[model samples]
Target: MGKTTRDRLLQTLASAFELPEDVVLDLTRITITGNTQFLMENHRGILAYDPEKISLRTDQGETVITGRNLKIDSLFASEIMITGSINGIQFIRSRG
Candidate 1:
């Protein structure tokens, strides 16, 4: 019903079931290779995109990618593949 409640529930269930935090919380997953490729799974949607930056929404919160010549090589409902000279990645969690 609320952030504290939900978080407590997740923690309780996770500990009781011996489940990973991500699996128990239903969070997004990210994969990166070198500095040229990026992939995200369980993404909600894209928030912003440009040659130098891209922002995406996820179940956990928002993710921002910054770099040069960034391009979305492939996109799916729940997954995205990006290619470029990735300079940085940031994850922003929503405040309760």
Candidate 2:
């Protein structure tokens, strides 16, 4: 049988790390509500920060979320959620 799209993607990603099939890959998902919002996903994880309120950096890149009373309420082990009135969102990739 052929591999599913998800399985193929996973396999391709796994090849980069020389990881075995059993090696679980970490994934991050971000969601925002209100006026402004931002979402970023990378091999490292998800990062949600307010450009007007805070500055951030990552091996993957930078993501800026701007809005009124923009608040990053939760940043769990693998996901991030932002809330409040927002104006703009930007994503920047710095490296591999």
TM-scores of the candidates are 0.85, 0.46
Clashes of each: 0, 2
Worst 10 residues of 1 by lDDT: 20-29
**In model 2, where do residues sit more than 4 Å from their true spots?**
1-28, 32-51, 54-59
Model 1, global lDDT: 0.91
Q: After superposition, how far is residue 61 of candidate 1 from its true place, in Å?
A: 2.2
Q: How do the residues 8-96 of candidate 2 rate in per-residue lDDT, one tens digit apiece?
A: 78878798778864443433334554465544333244344443543334433565666677665656543355666767666677654
For model 2, give the 10-residue run with minimal summed lDDT: 21-30
> What local distance difference test score does each model get?
0.91, 0.53
Taking every candidate in turn, the Cα RMSD to the unseen true structure, in Å, is 1.7, 8.5
